[model samples]
Target: MKWRTLENTAKIFPATSGKKDERVFRFACVLKEGIRAELLQEALNKTLEEFPMFLCVLRKGLFWNYLEESKLRPIVREEYRTPCSAIYVRDQKNLLFEVTYYKTRINFETYHALTDGTGALNFLKMLVYQYLMLAYPEYVKGPVSKLGITSSTEEDMVEDGFSKYYGSGEIKEEIPRFKSYQFPYHRREHGRMKLIEGLVSSEKLLQKAREHNTTVTVLLTSVYLCAIAKDMSIRQKKKPVSLMIPVNLRNIFPSDSMRNFFGWIDIGYDFATRSNELEDVIAYTSDFFKRELTLKRIGARMDNLIQFEKNPLIRIVPLELKYIFMQLGAKFISVGENTAVFSNIGKINLPDDCESYLDYFEFYTTTPTMELCMCTFQEHMTLSFTSAFVTNRVEENFFSILKELNLDVRMIVSGDSRAGQEHFPDLSKETATHDFWYRLFTFSCLAVMVISNILNYLLIPEMFWSRYVMGGMASAWIITSVGYRKRRNLLKNAVWQLVLIGIGLYLWDYATGFYGWSLNIGLPCLILSCLAAITAIIIFFRLNSADYMIYMMITCLAGFLPLILNIAGIVQFKALAVICAGISFLTLAALCLFQWPAVKNELIKKFHV
Candidate 1:
């Protein structure tokens, strides 16, 4: 398989993304009519031809992660799961982007490692254009012909713009080290997000920006900072309300690459030292944008970023260790300094011919804190805020500021775009039922334990059998917990159960008496049974060798422990131990002979450091 290196900016995503922040973004184009799934698939097929780089999958290397060409293809489906849900599995070969539709909206969601918002918007535009042409050929012959739209060459689409524009210069990057204030509100359930999309008139927002003598981004960022300040206490106000604004590098560096070609600047306003007036905030934001958004400053930042990636010692570090350091950098350094993210995807322009067929464009990204994404189409600008917090106090305060300015702000709640309902599934009913049953079962368990202790005190008065019952319940809880946590990977769950059950059985034997039965008979039997069961599972499921080899090796190593114990004179019985040892040795030797390459690679990845 052919592979390519990831850009410097793209390397951090895999390490930092989790259930809370998926590092995924969505671009949706709502048309006047409902979306036809078949026609949308056809359009996606045509669009993928022009953007082949998006077809690759992220892979692990010795020292870094890379993208490898994948044979898997994307298919358009009706939107079922939440938007911006995880698309990249660590070792799975799946597409980095997905096209899903709901009602009249055509949603294009992409993993940040594949492309940034600007690059994804280009792909969505092409897809919408193609779908329109296929759906209405007559309109294409009329209005579409008047506009000129052509696909860029594939070579340009896959170009690494960072490498192309990186200059050999001394880096003098300075980042403020002060900690920013984070929202104290509790987060929603995992994989659940609250989206507050404010649709307003572009003309009115522009006029307001003009009155402030600032650009729309600076003005809106000012409003966002002020909104966050509304909920801050006097003590919290000491920290600055900082916003990380992403800038399109293609505009300044001149590249047609669809890969990640963007940079960000941090702008903040300290309410403690400066005036809290809106005008003051706008002026501060505008001044910071001017100073930090220049070509020289951005290039220096980019050079600094690239220099770290190019370091000899850093390059030699294993990918697994790199993930730890990068994850720490993202948590303490990247996330610690920013209060929120405000990404301006800027204005989205479609052909005038097809503009009437579209309602507007919407953009939003998953974030660990609050993020305000702005996109304009025709006369409408969609300001989308996706937050991890359960409360929308900051988002509500944001629109309240806009409403105070006399700007028309309407909530986009039509069709499936309603907050908490559009992206997340309605699980309240099911959750209620599950919670009721759980509570009932827990109460029953407590009642049973109390009854057993009372009966033991009345009848036996000295046996204390209830203690063994408590031990049994504890063992069952541990086993069930492992099963629930590792449900996604049955092989891993089986391995855990095998190890945990062995320990539990030995402890039970020790409590009964210091007998050698657990070591000589019970443990050997459990290991033998686990080996047989896992082998049958692999055959039945046709699992990949890479997925099960490590677990199998672990079980085989455990199988030898029984014979070792017998040889140490700890086991009175020896027949079962000898059988387990012989089978384990054969199993291990067969794995080395048949699946040597996978075993070798797995070992290297685990112990590379």
Candidate 2:
């Protein structure tokens, strides 16, 4: 069967609103040390020159999308910068060797759009081991047979031993169930990770989970649940905190993409609210979530989404106006939505070759952006733990949980990533470009936003109640004020903005269908409006040094903003659903460009006078 291009209007709702689709994420881990950065850089230069495949990203309808920026491959880095470095940045690493370092820490980052937590973990373990030999002089190094790399050291390691999972497998087609709707794409607030990267086997972790009378995910989830509860209790004395564990629909569906093939299903009970017995909490959560993970439920969810997207129209209201209502509903009600997500990618496999030389993997879960994500992966038997948290308190709780489990963390290490650690360093010392032309470009962006908002306010009617209008206005307002001092209260205001947009989108759908308006017009606007809104917030936060709190507020805002887009009249344009997600991604990319004022200012400085 030919892989079809995702429709401009994707079949969202059931399959994960394309907003959370598998195709959009990517994960990469760096390994190597002792060698000068230049050596690794040279190796990367050779590798890319040798094999184009060394740098690629996944493409729509295609399994792999390599880096379009080939000369300098854009690597998705997951940098661990805490316990010393706290900033995490994602970018392209020109060379594979730069990722591995015996002198410094290794770096790893994942693209949620590419693969789920599990899939990325497999890749990370292998990537790390490959780096180990190349960096340590004792591990293994020969002519880089894989992608292309030449190292000075030589060690015996089987490349096949590194990877533990399959690229291709029996695919079963099953549908997943979840409340579906349409909204803009968003980037969550992501924080630093206190990572514990080790070597543990899947078999051991599963056995442990079973021994604890829990599923692997449940057992891992228990760690997070316990950690979060502890974090909350230690902090502001909040009640039981809720957690969301992303259940891959593909796991139950059989026929799902290995990439972006999952949905975040809630999986936490208030730790403080949990039963006195850990068994009760574990059993209840395991059982409850276990049922939610079935193919039947997934199918029903997808089926309902299909129906919702395909239903008949209500030809009474205008398209734009209808969306306003749905957007409103989403904002007022949904966006401040689910509390937090705690996901687990069960024991993962490194490629067979690197297995013997490798350790386990680590990953983090973020929604919009999470308060903290307590994730663990078992390689052989030792459970490697990681806690992605914005603050020390949240991290401490995660560590405390391991102690409670009677598993003492054996070691702690830190890494230096120009991307993550040097995130927003002082601008005065940096030197980039400060061209007059670039200065003009900066002004041009703000100018364009100003003009766009002005045009929107002028062209859009005041009386019309559509989510697009609300979202656009709100988004515009955010961007306009983005360069100013931060506004914490705006978090709630932003929440309301998304809420209104959700309501407006829902209502506007009815108006468009009832009035016999073209869905093409209604949907593109609706979906793209979500695109814009999510983008605006992401940009706002990204410019502010990747602030986790703001990201949390905005992602939560975007997550539930689309429920009503399919209400009555709107047709589910899955292709457009994908479009919304893609555009939102673009928005995020744009924001990432401006992540650091010094870097941005450098460019302007160079191009300016």
Candidate 3:
């Protein structure tokens, strides 16, 4: 039940998260056989015991949101959702990580709030090791001991390394900041992040880098910059195509914490300022790496970050307000300050026994514009390019550079193959036909309403005729609501629509007559029906119940309105009101009883009173 404030660097993730940028990272382990659900779940349970930090849920504190150990358990399932989808702590309060298997691949996705790639990789390693031991006991060696799981103590695993190293007030020197060149933002089609992976021989790539007198990361950064430069307009050519390189701090600061302990260095090449030669880009990147990768520079930057967090004014602000400022800060820091991120986890070295059971390791980071993650296993090195932009010109140019280097590259694209196609087949005819029917139906509804209203006004002047018009309008609304196409969460959207219609119907009935039916039956029935339907969907679909708790709570609150109306003598039906109140109270009480610890923890974190 212990709670810990988020690490200094980890605070930005929740603030910056949005529909397109989820702030989640994916680390997939391709196993030799299909993942056994039972074994994986068991393995995750066992792994959680050792790395308890990863089992925590995020909660809001007065000044900042913190992580607290969750009472719920992590479950394993088949992979169904898209990779790197948003992991809302409110929804999945138990764990900040997800484990799913697709065929032979075990996908381990972690929210950046909980841990960074290094921490997640350690957790995944242990999970896979345990799974292998359970599934193929004959092939696996010793019990998790030989898996190279970090021997860091639980205290160390949860340690705020940034604060540990830089919290002291002694380092007061102000570090100068510079504005880097920005890449022009392109709107991604449908806001779907696309991943394109290229597998090349590790030896060939290393040899090519050595010939240029640079390391793999520097060489790859150079090539990536070259690719970006190709698409730069004459106006943009003056700006530096900066690449943000994430450096793992564990190597420098010597902390065993699995929490976020990383720093980034911006490396750039200005085509308009200097030669766009590959060698020049490499040398420039190498020089920057040599200077910025040093502990002195990184430590100074960490100190500067800590100073901002330690500001007295910042410390007193409420969490909600802090979230707004942090979001604006994250956005301001990102826009025009850098081009893209290049995170290289380097070659993954597994124990000899476990190596044969694994195929390859893949890493993906959610990016605002574009991100490239590099990892190598055995002879093949894979460079994964995840972009928010639809076009793959940068990726194409990157691989084309490798092809020129005489390296045999194999490309694999996730999602649609027509993503980067120049000539998209015309769908106007199909869309026109669909729109035509929709417009026709809409026009028909409007015409009926107008004509019926006119005829009723003209012929039935003595009679109340607006009811017919109201009926027509209701019919039109119902048709429109039902006919609308929802691409995602269709059932949830439909349920909401039904609830809205139910409310409208009750209001209309109340306006027509204080018929005891709407209040006596309709309102209570709608409340109970929505509750029942949503509960059934959650249970049947095996969705996370925490995700729908807010909706259920709102329904319960709405249920009370009927009882208040009854007390006010607006609705004379006492029986229905009592029934509605009973149901709402009982449901809410049940939630509190079952999830008291989580609820209490959430309140403590959110209100901090």
Candidate numbers sorted by lDDT from highest down: 1, 3, 2
Provide the clashing-pair count of each candidate structure.
Answer: 0, 149, 1
lDDT-superior candidate, 2 or 3: 3
Against the true structure, candidate 3 reaches a TM-score of 0.71
Give the clashing residue pairs of candidate 3, or none: 60-605
Better of 2 and 3 by TM-score: 3
Over 346-394, each residue of candidate 3 has an lDDT whose tens digit, in order, gives 8887777778888788888788788999988888788889888867788
Candidate 1 residue lDDT tens string, 292-318: 877888888788888788888998998
Question: Candidate 2, residues 1-609: lDDT per residue as tens digits?
Answer: 011122111212112211222112223332222334554444444434433332433221111112222233543333322222211112212322124333333444443433344444434443444444455555455334542222211111111110112222222434322231111223322333333333334555566678787776677666656555553433322334456456655465443232334545554364444563556667877887767666555454444433432334422333334345545654555543444555555444443444454343334332333433324333333333333333444445555665566554543322111223332122234333434554565566666666666776678756344444444554544444442222333443444444444455545556556552334344445445544554576577563332223333244334322333434435454454455445555545555565545334323322221
Alpha-carbon runs more than 4 Å astray in model 2? 1-110, 118-211, 231-240, 255-258, 268-274, 304-336, 351-353, 365-391, 411-609
